[model samples]
Target chain A: MLWAYLHCYQLTLDTYTPLQQGGSADEPTVVYHENSNSVVQMNAAAKQHGIELGFGLAQTAALCPQAHIIKYDKDVEKQALLSLAHQLYPLASDIVINTEHSLAIRLDNLLQYYGGYDVLWNTLTHEINQQGIHYHYATAWGIEAARVLAKSQINQMLRERTAITKCLAHCKLSYTDLDSKALNALEKVGITSIGQLLTMPVHELGRRFTNDTIRYLTALRGETFPTRTLFRPSSTFKQHTVLPFEVENSQHLLPYMGKLLDTLSHYLRARNLTTSSLCFEIQLREAEQQVMPVSAATPFTCATAWLDLVSLKVERLVLQQPAIALTLLCEDFEPIEKDTNDLFSDRFTHLAQKQLIGRLKAKLGEQSTQLPALGNSHIFEKMTVYQAQGNGQSYGFDAAPTFLLDHPKPLSVASRVCFGPLRLQTGWWEENTQKQDYFIAQTPQGVRLLVFKDTESKWWVQGVYS
Target chain B: MKDSLSLFNNHPNIWRAREQPANTSRFALGIHTLDEALHGGIPSAGVVSIACTTGIGEVSLFQQVISQQRKHKLRVFINPPAHVCAPWLTTQGIDISQVLIITPDNDADALWAAEQCLKSAACHCVLLWSKTMAAKTARRLQVAATHNDALCLLFSLASKKPSSLPVSLELSLKAHEANLTVDILKQRQGWPVHNLSVPFSWTPDNHAIQWAIKNNKRKVHSLHSVS
Candidate 1:
């Protein structure tokens, strides 16, 4: 059972590069843990200026005054590690994110499929180099042993138990998972190296040290295996990007928003899914955060199409404050529907119609376009309804006027009646009853109208034949 | 001189009127007199401008043509004067499912929506009701309709004199008693016809109207007996 461990020592620095502003290549950059207030990672330029790890902020400033400082976030580092693991998932199936900056993979099962260890290593290195992250990797008989060797920057592959034990002997106690108390206790006893600690009997050491120390020694020696949760890709797509500079205009946010959409498109295509809507949460500099939702008439997985719709919506948006950050979230995903087309059909009319509706809705409001529907009502106004596509019923009616006025106008002039005194009385159950005698009237201009006289003896023109 | 003349003749942007395609498909207007006057019918794919007023049976005159053109295809209405009654459209044999209504707030959006719908090639016909339109905008709509094989009907309020616009057909409608008077203001390949009468059945004899009249008489007779 060979376990390969990878440690991303400069994870915070690597994750910060994509989000930082355009800075000079020679400028030194350093990331410090906010809680500890000590430098965790630094670029080569800072090292050249005599900066070291664990240096306090004041000390680093005194060393390299021109260095760029960034606060380290554990969650961001974890997310970056998870993304890296997802990239390596196809190459190695059994992967465990052992720590915030390290992962362990069981590679013995995959050696046969890759035909040898060198090809697998080449493939893994190629993928890691493509991401441009600095990493240290090592392999041993046990996961804990491999992790210790990787953390100590001993980059090698070992399959024999003797070789792994020989390498483990040189690793110091500080690289192990021992607490500071255990380290101090071992130091007092003159045991500084893992080689010295392993030579002692377990029962004898059990009397000298705590149970946790003994367990750590036993796991490092491949006596017991630690249970670890394997890494699995997330089902939903979400990306949060911190803008290097504040954007005042909504149009300027497109380039940043477009990058996030491209990532989402890649994720969706990898999973063979499509989404109908996306919600963008814009973090403003001073005002409250705004959530802009862009939806498509049909499910889509292409980035350019979504970008077109988003640009149209963003063009009409009014920005209240400068935006400092942006988060894109899409939780619901649907299986891509296979489109069936007839061989003789020349035009993609259905897709074109959906695209037209989506464009109109993006420019105008969502409720601007509707399909005509019929309702079950006696009132002319209530009988015709306009609703969204695919949700209305169609019922045939008798002869009626072509156009109905939204508000009936009062009949002030006299006109000759051509047809009926047809009476319509409805809405009794709701207590808003109506009774009217309707007629087809023609004015002197030869324009025919649908007129009605209510019980109050007032005449109203409801519609026109045209 | 000969080389330049050939170059001028071969230019793509220069469109000569006599070079217009002659065998374009036509949809019958369903009016005998108007069909005869048009030689075949309305051009299936181009701009047709009509100058008329509301409540003049102008919509009724085109009801037959719209229904016939909208078979298994979408029809869009951009900024109509009033709410189009679905029941009336259904009674005229129009598929209500294929009708789309877009009510834009301003005329600019209305014209834009019309052009998009025509260019999409998904719609069979587009109807737009606006007071006035610029000549450039009309030409754009005409080009879009011709290229995509879609029909655009521009309805404007009738003026005393006609304005020149690059449209395939232009007609002025007047409401006569039980008939619509159509005067062909312009046509692409035909002479202008004047005062062509097309009759419409405004008041059809139906059982629903007859039953209502009889019911009203019964109510009046019963009231008189009680008094």
Candidate 2:
């Protein structure tokens, strides 16, 4: 049978001492229950001076003057238990939460799922530890044996099959019963083993012993136990609605574009999953249902990209107007993961590149940030300006001349400084395209620029080298 | 020059072809095809400014690098700003757990946390888009990216210069109605400036990325190569 665990309980000073408050400085907090006589704390103190729990408070104080006491909190214990319970829910279906800060789920069903029971238990224990709650208790084969085995000993949990079952059967039920009378009842029939208890008539024991003992023992023999349902976290998924207009023709879909973008973008950001691609849908009110899906060149999880994409579709051919609705559905997704770095990536790193880009974008807006072109072309018609994209990648050349005026400028004539006769011909194919004189001239002030004269007999400084 | 040279003498009637396809990933892509154009996917550890105005396939290019890393078994950290999403990339067939993202937000805290992440040794690359970074600051980030062995792919929303941020690959994207151009302003090793238009697309679930592997079309696409 497989092992299932819902939570774990760790021992603390409160569990050991019903009345002890905080421990000495530099020591861990002591566990104590309020005003209880059988404090594990007092018992230890009594050993020092031959005094115990039955002695009066004055005697106990005389025996151990440094003892500090505190009240126990079931709520705190439960909160801690619940934190662990949440972690174990994914691995098991039937979780039996126990009183001493541990839980047991039916393990018979989990053996194959986990490759083996031991692996499952270790995995569960590891996950709980990450949350800062120690897991010292566990059980397998159902809560029956699991209840009695919480923190009994590591060897008990390590046993195989019947040995493990026998181990649980022998452990004390101080946690499950949690009261003196129950403790008194189990104190000396001399046998606390479930195997031994099973030999006795259950009904007779139910009549003679406390209900808690009867119930605890009954559940130990693979019986059904009552439990409450726990909620699982929601998975990331999204859907959008379409407007009611009928699509008679392409012009009618323009109005719905804005709303569609809003819906898709909202869903994506909410789950932190951006859509690199989406399928746009349109329905005709009168025609038989036709499911036409259109995907973007890229899956865009951003609103602006969604807007731009939809605008492109509409602009390409105005979607038919009077269309019943335009709906966007992202059929696929990429899960976002936490960052973990590679140990052997490049060492020639560019630090703060992201921060710099983010800052520039935040201040200047993307359209205005232009990369200075690398060239010294000195003619208004010969200089070029390129827009930017994803990383500072400049748009490759367009139909415009390979080189254009970096900035179109008024021609300067400084006593006919002759620019080299760089031949530019635009007239071979197109009429009236004039060739011009291009020169790299250095003014006396150290201002070096590429200058050119146009067919119109006008001169212009194209660009500078700085 | 300590360089391996292949000089194809101009034999007027020569029609010889190389026996095996050489790994022409001149830059990191190492695929001689795209490598000849993009030097090793913008270099390993440096601040690169990739600007896209309308439609230069900037995001697609980023995807290519991420795809390469995943294929070679490396981690990818992406921080896509809130405004521009479609063109934002998530492809490249990397394991979801290997790709970490800093959700887009306007506050400095989010970006700062992202910076601390880049300084770490847990990731192979860190890509970010900031609408507010300044010139000198961009240079400072580049320095950090170098120290950590992580490539910092920056999307500049602004065009100002702080004169401090030196970059290996400065690309400006120009997107027209249909045509796209990527002009390289600076290159660290080869051509200081050039422009190339490469077609790009993304499958939501990296289906193409994975298929490219199964179909053994890896030279053209490197995304889902399982180690």
Candidate 3:
């Protein structure tokens, strides 16, 4: 029944910082929520300047004028927490994103893999520190108790329920999940520490306060609280970024586009899916938008392959106006089984071909390379049509020459007929009608050709049978 | 030079020039006399150019190559001057199912398709028809074919004069009376061969054609009466 809780105290602040841009970004930062009228989070630099969590926004501004304040976005914080949960998903199966700022994972299965609880705790804290994120974590026999201990800033590992009970006994009642009115009433009755409230009779507490207070006390001590919804990854990814300035050249927008691609890569890896099409929209300053789509010949999961294709497409674009922002949207994806290569297989050759074809299509147009496919017509011109690969159907028909002339030329010299009086005069319903008798013939010289005579008795060389 | 040889004898690990192995594995050209002239046949990689004043036996040569390579890999034809007739190809025992025809609008696309198909290894043979090509472009196609172990055959409607292209084999075909005479101008590490006469035949049986015409006439008459 051992469970672990991870609380990212500065989830809102980290979501707004450009940490992946790889430059020095250590500044006094705070996320101020206007609707809640409080400072939701602050980095250490802001804390050093006397800015604290839960302070009024105006009070924080007054206390620390040097703080870099950003408006808080709850959706960003939730997405960041979801991403963090996805990263920790391989470590455990039953992961619950408890709130916008915290996650809870059952750790019984993870302890066996990490060898011990001490090593797991050290590894988790070390990774969080390396990611430049502020977090507090604790493990207990109950998930709710672990969450309460984490919120109360008591970072320790409790093996037994009694140890958790003992730890909660010393803590004050302010850290419980009970409502504020219940806490105020409890404080008025001289019950300060959790031990005092636990020592009191349950009926007496129930008589004084509502049943919710007694229930809260019970849940804090690992009695109830079992209902939880496990976190599942979303199906689609939509991310956008506004450039710092008006970008006239698409090459300059690559770095900003890179950030969105990183987020998309993480999303794809978490769900084990690959995308075939990606649509990018650039919002230009001329009151119009440019929609560019990059598609792959085959479904792919590698992020660099997709990025290289997108870079080539961007390089070939001729922007009509300066762009102010860009958005990347990908909704259609196919689930793919992970590839397992054998020892004697030429796996790289196939991969190299796909990549080469993809790059060539990106550089040249899609129609530059075509494969022959059977068309649904009996006429010579329409019998076999050249189409892009995977875009046509195969139809069985009569025998025809491997090459036909682009234009049928009038032949003056006579030739001996070898095979065909195959008459083909069927398209009368269309504007351009043809009525001709075709023959496969060879001249006195060694050239073999396909000759046809129209209704006007004019002989023409349709194609050479070479 | 003697000291160097002694040094090589003392230390076998020292690097020296090794003898070039003879290329034995080749794709038979399907013509017995031409195969003998070619020592065995064409190497499975590199370029073979057919230079001619007029396109006399070019189509027949293409048909032979296509049918031969059809069983092993995809046969790609890039930008022939006319539309390829599939029925004739299928009649020559070429598998039309494995044949892909690319119709590029210009020479650049033809060259590009040739290079890409050679490098992809998806196609074992690529046949390109172009009026003219730069020496650099021809060399690029040669290298790509050699690197990927695919065959490249270029049928040119130009002269057979000496050029800077590193073509492994070059043959000039002249349309003589009732037969095709092919002159081997260049062969890698082999003596030049004189004109060799070859026979060409591509006509269906008389009874087969008669039977086909009878069915076709019946279909036409039935459609006319119904209309």
Candidate 4:
């Protein structure tokens, strides 16, 4: 089987640049390993300033005083690599995230469908170029060989055994997966290039190098296959982003939140699903993490629509402390239901109605808006219920008051009975028992009220007919 | 002078009253004299302001109008005076599922919610209860309602001073026993009418009265026997 390997040489730089705030495109930037304290990757601007790889922090600062220094994060680099793999999943069927900054894709199965190698390579390159990531790729008969070649910056696609052997000969031994000890031993034995190492027999090198190095040389030569777990898209979407600077204001988190939502939108679209709610966990500097849940009335996949709802909620948000990081988690996913409509009818009304509810709930608290529903109760006050979402059950009742008061007021004005003496003596199980004689009373001012006389013989007005 | 007049006429923002397109579609108020006074009925799409006191049969008067507009569309009630009884809404033949009630903390949010519901085009009718409304706010609500072909009914407490807000129809309601006295304060493309009596559909139910009479007879017999 043929395999193709991709190496994201500037994974740290690419992931860091998008999240970096207030930096010009022409500005020089470099990311250095925290432990090693040496530059791992640099942009072209920094490269032009003679700042090379493995340069210490002091050396980098001395070379370009204006250079932006960023510490490398392995976890962020891995997430970026996985996100890149997810983007390319549609193009390549079988993919393995080989390293924190590289991926291996089996292309034998795709070659037949794509007709040829050139077409598949073009399709892969087009998708990668759109992401604006700097990558080097090499295709070979084995995964290890392809990874080694791509890591060494030898960008070529070789199908023939002779061509691959000739290409591997020119690559230095340092580019191989062998350890430094094995390389030093091989160098002491006057072996510099992979071409010289290939000339030696396995048993002849076995006495000098370790067994692991022997296995690596065999796998790099396409004699053995290494097992790897292929990458599959996760069912749930979760993304954690560290802010380059502390955002004291909740509204300023919009740009960072917006980027995460865009990525979420892509993830949802790729899976043909929609979500109605998203949980945002804000990592404050000195306070407990704040969780802000933004929900929509209807499930949708548009990032801008979700952002609109989020911004409405964010405008009223009071941050307890300055936020340093943000995590977006969405666990529930629903399949999109196609709305069937008449050819001439307007289809946007349904969506607009749901969006209106979302906007109202976002601005004025969730409980501010409610849908009127009927409840199963004989008591006048317990008959109506308000729901936050969904269509209420259609239940009909006879001749009720127009509006019910939460608390009954004492009958103060002189009133005449219009229609009355309907005794409602139910509610035996509940503590608040109903044993009153209800009446339809009209005051002298021509106002109709739903009045009742209780067990104490005191008159109380419950509601109005208007 | 002709050139200046032509310039004013050709301006995009300037339009004479005669040049404005008349909206003719209306929903019958189900009140004969009231419908006749407003020509066809209430204009189906613009803002209609009602000045009335609470508990004066004003809500029951528009019950039929609101119910008729909820045909697969939402009807929003912003800041109703009290809890709108679901059973009462059902009695008016309104689909409870299509009714949305928004109780905002203040009038500003209530007005904003009203404008949003009107402009959404998903709501066929919006009813807002406010004590006072500025002319600018009324005009904004009118524009929003007109854009989406939605009706907005603004209900304010009755005041002695007449409002000069731009609305399609303005009526002042007064309670008069079983009928409500509706005076058309202002109407679009029609002359104002005074003291149009519109009867309420909620008459005293004879069944309830009969039931009450039978119970009263039973109570009297028991009291007489005990004495």
Candidate 5:
């Protein structure tokens, strides 16, 4: 089996001080944890200025006064790693992220599909570069050996155990999974590299070092398999982002909500899915949460379409309190089918129709728009039922008014029936049976109406044909 | 960017004028006289206001437009005066599913619903009923309809309103002697035409005709129908 390890060596610094536009890459940066009272990470420029990781914050400043210090955000780092895993998931057979800074992917199955290792390596590198992340990769016969090679920044693909062992001879002992005390003890005993450590007999090393060290060394050489949990995409999407400030009005909350939607779009795209509805919740200060649902008539994946609908919802919203946080949850997702448009079909028209329905549903309400389906029923009202609009086919049946009255209204005696005896009667099985003769009539004034006479001989005006 | 900006700036007429007068774009008001008077047809976009007396066939006009336009897109009725007869609409070959009826509580809700439907581009036409409207709301509705290239027609019951209302076409409709009289009070880029008679096909029942004639003759007396 062939495995490739993507080692994100800069994860700590990247998480702490995200490279912003126009920020100098050569600037000295350090990540200082105040609770631990030490510098956890520093860039190469900071190292050049005599500032090393694990230095106290005071010592860091003393060593390099111009170094920029930032606190590491673990949540952001975990999210970044997970997002990377999702992007790589579709390209690999199986992926296991064993540590915060690296992921191991099974690549033997993909070699044939990707036209061998070189093409896959180029594609992977291009994608990583496009996303503006720095990574080093190594491929070996086993997962642990590949991970060790990747930690040493060896960007080589080794298929044989002999070649992998030769490469491991140069890898530093500090890069392995051994404890600092054990490593330091070994260093004092003239063992500074993995090569020297492996030279010692297995039984001798097991007696001298802890059991974990022996096992780690065994795993490092691809001698024993290491345990790793396979990464899987979550079934439902729930992303929350704290607003920068307390937003008193819905309009002010749009920018924050927009950011959350962008993240949700990224999540959906990675999974190749689309959602018809999403629940948007706003957590307010000392007030009940405002949960608004934004839905489309059709399942949609476009970020802008969802953003537009949610923006309309926000516009019509009356915020009861100042919102301090926002959460977007979309639990239901359907596999998205990419439509291949025909040359004859007008693409804009179809998109425009969907946009229109989405806008109408957002502004007017979900019940505002519907599609008509012809049912097999004798009663006129029962013959046509308005179903909620989606991808359902619209049935074009016999001539009928586009409008239907909710209830029949009694007509005045002065109202005149112009056309009559379009008989319609049904509901025999049910208690509310109807025996009626319907008419397309005009009132004495001029207004055309649809009137009907029930079996009891009472006349009612069903609707004005407006 | 400079070339694109200047290209549009140099040819303002490209954005201002109607792109085409094809059947796909323009709505046939279903009356030949009205269509001719509209110079091709009711524009696919922009608001057309109908100032009417009671029973003047404004509902019939909207119904005709709805029936015709349903083939292309949905039709929206905002604040319809009465319930629409679904079965009747069905018999007219109008897709009942393509029709949306909205009953708004007040003028603001009605105006908002109208603007939304117009801007949605989901509906080929939006028919709105309003007794009165502030000029600003009418302007907003006009802009929305134009932006989405959808038709918006407002049926106003009060006929004696201002002549300078924001609308593409303003016509006063009056039903007289079994014929609908359409008076073009205002129209864009055309002279105001008055008292053009459009023939109405449906005739009232004989008994109702007798009742109406008697009521007219009495003038001060109420006439009840013989049931």
Candidate 6:
């Protein structure tokens, strides 16, 4: 149809401000039913006066005053909207966002589940209004016609399937079937409404209109609606949110992120899943969004695990402004595998050991803990050493004297016995100044070890029998 | 020096639990004797501290532990300073294929890696070449060893002995002939520690040095001392 029905609202008055005063965020107040980038939605008094949606600021304040105007934040709005989409994903086959405040969804499949069209509409409207939003809806065969009707009509009927096609056929099908350029001549002929435009011949419409217009007209008549295959879900986890308006502060997104975390954690736990890797994406107003990724060495889950891994990656953010939208996604994850360990068996001891080791490592640090090994050397001065990895050896046993003289019991011998059993002298040049007389003895207990007399003539045992 | 390394080195040797004369899996170091008398043997995991002021037979003792564990198929990871003569441990019955040497430039790294291995519960035993360690870390290792059922040993230069230790055996050192005089100072499992000592020494066969033959198998000789 050649009808040019404009949504008559003083949206600009309440939407924007002097470009100098506000810059990119500055705009007029009258909040359109949808964020009409064509008009501002941030004018001060107009917004306060309940003059929001589809108006100019200059015109808004004149009609109504005392409005709390807001600046345009497309990024935030897109994010908030996308998040809403994820939540409602189970309801519809195709949900297309028209603008920040508007959505185009096919309700045929979900109609029965929702108890019919009116019930669904009422529920959706209630949900939207609960978010402090004043909303409106429009339906037409063509996407552009739907947008225009939604703007022009303050309150539109919700149509279902074939009925939707019938209701939208007039305005949508006419322009779609004959195209406007073909109707430009009709325009000169004083033809406008679809009723009037239909009188024109089809060949005339095709001859004058573009192919797109003709195709859309057929589409509106239930011949086609761009049938897309049932969406095949991919193996990924994603979360997002939509905003009533745009926002730029990063902190402002925390509450939204909290909601995402709740949803994500529930999803994972339901499937007994754990993820050690995740990705984050933030959408901007007009520029490309940013993507950040996080990884852990092992599978992790719930709030604590995810938070720990994320904290490391988020420490490097350098944003000068706030993010408008956010998305949390987990592309890969592992299933939570089960393990069996007896409650009181030694197998559980490893966990205990882990606890002890962790506590010590935390307190004393890693450097302080070590395992002793044997020093590989011959000279007494060179040999008496322990390495951390002593090669799984027991001490003094391998080198114990095979001859068991006796067990541990004091030898009441002369304190300074000049027993020339064996004068062992070595390491003189290597600073090992030693002059010792050694002996192998058997105590009353049948213990055998190497004993020696120092230069001072005092006797003592050095090592024990295995 | 890169000599200090754990079993993690992609060498042919690998991590295996102790399995042998099953009873020997538990080494009952005369707690009454060695525990109070000296630093404990190598830790099942974590750092084990030991030192010799005089003829302590440090290498000989390390060899015994290594040989025993090796007999049960446990691998020995060695990290020694540049001064350690590798042949000494071999001479004490430690299997050549079982011994993995990690020469280390930083003594601290060697110590840390050794503890980590023990902490992992992957290796039968771990050893660090060190002269000293913090008391807290030593105790933690004792607890870990008990939990994981593995042993850890640390070698340290003898200074002042630790006041309270978790060691099962403590020995006072003296040398006579080719034996190490082990004076029993403390025992954990009721090992008697009086003025008496265990006669132990290492002897070489081919390139392997081992703890002397069974004390009972040796010649029946006794030292009658003055009253």
True contacts kept of each: 0.75, 0.00, 0.47, 0.78, 0.33, 0.01
* lDDT against true structure, model 6: 0.48
Residue range A1-466, candidate 4, lDDT tens digits: 8898999999878876777666576689999897998999999999999999999999999999999887798998898888888888878989999889999989889988899989998899898877678898888888888877887887887788788778878887778778888888888999989888777888897787778888888788777887889999888988888776689898899998998899899999888899999999999999899999999999989999999899999999999999988999999999877662334344567777889899999999988899888876678887887752255444456758888888999999999888767899987887867798988888876788889998999999999887
Candidate 5 lDDT at A285 equals 94
lDDT of 3 by residue, A1-466 (tens): 7788888888766655653234435667888888988888877778888888889877887887767777777776786677676566655677888888898877777878899878876776665665456777777766767887888878777777778778877776667777889888988988788878766766787788877667767666666776789877666777666554578988987777776677677678767777878888998998789999888877677778788888978888877899877788889888875552334234544455556567667766676554555666667777666552365554453436656787888886777776668888777898877777888776776566778888999888877756
lDDT of 2 by residue, B1-227 (tens): 32332334344322344333223222254334345566445676777777653123344555556656623223433344322111122223334333434443343644563455456544566667666666666666676667766677777643545232476467765543223445666655545444555443211223444666789753655598777
On DockQ, the leading prediction is 4
lDDT by residue (tens digit), candidate 1, A1-466 = 8999999999878765655545654578898887898999988888999999999999999999989887787877887788788778878999999989999989889999999888888898898887678999899877889999998889887878888888889997889988999899989989989998778878878888888778888888787777778998888877877665688899988887887787788778878899989999999999899999999988788899899889989988887899988889999899886652344233367767887888888886766777888876668887787653354554555647778898999987778888777888888888899888998888877777899998889899998887
DockQ-wise, the better of 4 and 6 is 4
Model 2 deviation from native, Cα RMSD in Å = 22.5
State the lDDT of candidate 1 residue by residue for B1-227, as single tens digits: 99989987898755556674355578887888898788778898899999987778776677767898757667888898888888888887788878888888899988989999999888889998988799999999999999999999999999997788899999898888777889999987767899998886654434466787787676334545753
- lDDT on C-alpha atoms for all candidate structures: 0.83, 0.48, 0.73, 0.85, 0.72, 0.48
Candidate 6 lDDT tens digits, A160-257? 44544444434532433354565575667676655444345566657755677666544434344654333333357886654334556554454555
User: What lDDT score is found at residue A124 in candidate 1?
Assistant: 89
Candidate 4: regions farther than 4 A off? A22-28, A44-51, A60-68, A112-119, A155-167, A197-211, A338-352, A387-397, A412-416, A428-431, A443-445, A454-459, B1-23, B201-227
Per-model DockQ? 0.51, 0.02, 0.31, 0.59, 0.22, 0.03
The number of clashing residue pairs in each candidate reads: 0, 120, 14, 0, 14, 164
Q: Report how far residue A187 has shifted in candidate 3, in Å.
A: 3.6
Model 5 lDDT tens row, B119-225: 76677788898877878888898899888778888888854546677777787887765678888887665667788888765323355567778887864544875
List, residue by residue over A163-208, the lDDT tens digit for candidate 5: 8889888887777777889888788778888888757778877777
Residue A146, candidate 5: alpha-carbon lDDT:
81
Q: Which predicted model would earn the best TM-score?
A: 4
Highest lDDT model number = 4
